[model samples]
Target: MREISLAEMPGLLGQEVGVSDWITVDQTMIDLFADATQDHQFIHVDPVRAAESPFGGTIAHGFLTLSLLSAMNFESIPKIREQTVGINYGFDRIRFVSPVRSGSRVRGRFTLADCRFRGAGMLMTTYDVAVEIENERKPALTASWITIVQFDPKDRPEGV
Candidate 1:
């Protein structure tokens, strides 16, 4: 996990940073997410119903995919740098291209899209993230997310 500063603009743009985990999209995991988010649609939680549905099996929730973005900060990418804080700015674009059925392997691919000055000890960086399902031609999800990762020595974000 190589970490750098936001002031290190343009240089990191388009760079493909490798995340640390090899995640499995299991049925138990999907069910857990369903329970947590109150999204227990049959397609995601009921094996019998989902088996009869078009998907042929239980699938992960789209929000579950979106939720993985926040999980990435802790699970996959480590803020190995000495930065004081990293804050979520927002999303530039987000799309759930394909279904992530239970019993699959997925990994995140990150491409730095834009990094610009956001003033007063902050830099806004846009990253294109793809959740690739193992052995699948199409990705499970695609998103462009923004983060203002700060290397400020004076103060840290309130929550951090």
Candidate 2:
């Protein structure tokens, strides 16, 4: 991950943070996600059945795409220089805008939306994230994602 000081983060607002390397969502990956989530909708798990549906073939689950944010964020988002830990702070909003067909490749593009000192050596930040399906006109999903970074009091900059 790229490393930047917490003090430098505010300057990055409204700017693209980074783009992640591409990853494929193959049938096996889709199936594994289905099994783990206990969601067996034919559109997601049955290619034969899905072929007859409007999507023309099986598609990845929305949550499966959503789950990719963690991996994508890890690869693309900047890390705070003095942070002792960072946690997923949950999303403010998410929308599945397009289907990710089996075997499709996807990548994330991130923009820093906002950042603020929450309190006591804690920082809260938001990212505007988009999951783009390779060669597709529309993105697979978009979200406003939040994260919290914590630093030891000693590591925090003066007055923060």
Candidate 3:
């Protein structure tokens, strides 16, 4: 991950920040996610049954795809030099644009959409993110993700 000063964050608004390495959405992953979420719908876990559906085969759950953003963010988003901790603040919006078929690959593209000081030692940042399916025109999902970063007051950068 890239490291940047607090002063440089504002300059990144509306700009693409990073793209993550591709992650394969194979049957094992889909099955594991289904087990974890207890979503045993045929389209997500039963390959034979799903093969008869419009999707033609099993697909990863939308939430499973969404959950991957954490790993993606860690791989791609920049680190604030003064940040001591970062927390997920949840999404303002999310859309599952398309289904991700089993054995497909996906990656995340992130853009810095907003950044603001939330408190003396905390910053609120929002990112517009998309999970792109390999070789597919439409993304698996798109979301507006918010996160909070905290740092020691004494470590804050000069000039806001």
User: What's every prediction's RMSD, in angstroms?
Assistant: 4.4, 1.0, 0.9
Question: lDDT tens string, model 3, 52-88?
Answer: 9999999999999999999999999888899999999
Question: What's the best-to-worst order under TM-score?
Answer: 3, 2, 1
Q: Give the alpha-carbon lDDT of every model.
A: 0.75, 0.92, 0.94
**Consecutive 10-residue window with the lowest summed lDDT within model 2:** 151-160
**Among these predicted structures, which one has the highest lDDT?**
3
Q: How displaced is residue 38 in candidate 1, in Å?
A: 1.1
Q: Give the Cα-based TM-score of candidate 1 against the true structure.
A: 0.86
- For model 3, what is the error of residue 14's alpha carbon versus the real structure, in angstroms, after optimal superposition? 1.2
Q: Which prediction has the highest TM-score against the true structure?
A: 3
Task: Assess every candidate by TM-score.
Answer: 0.86, 0.96, 0.97
Clashing pairs in 3: none
- lDDT by residue (tens digit), candidate 2, 22-134: 99999999999999999999999999999999999999999999999889988988778899988999999999999999999999999999988877789899999999999
Off by over 4 Å in 1: 6-9, 75-82, 153-160
Q: Which is the winner by lDDT between candidate 2 and candidate 3?
A: 3
lDDT minimum window of 10 residues, candidate 3: 151-160
- By lDDT, the better pick of 1 and 3 is 3
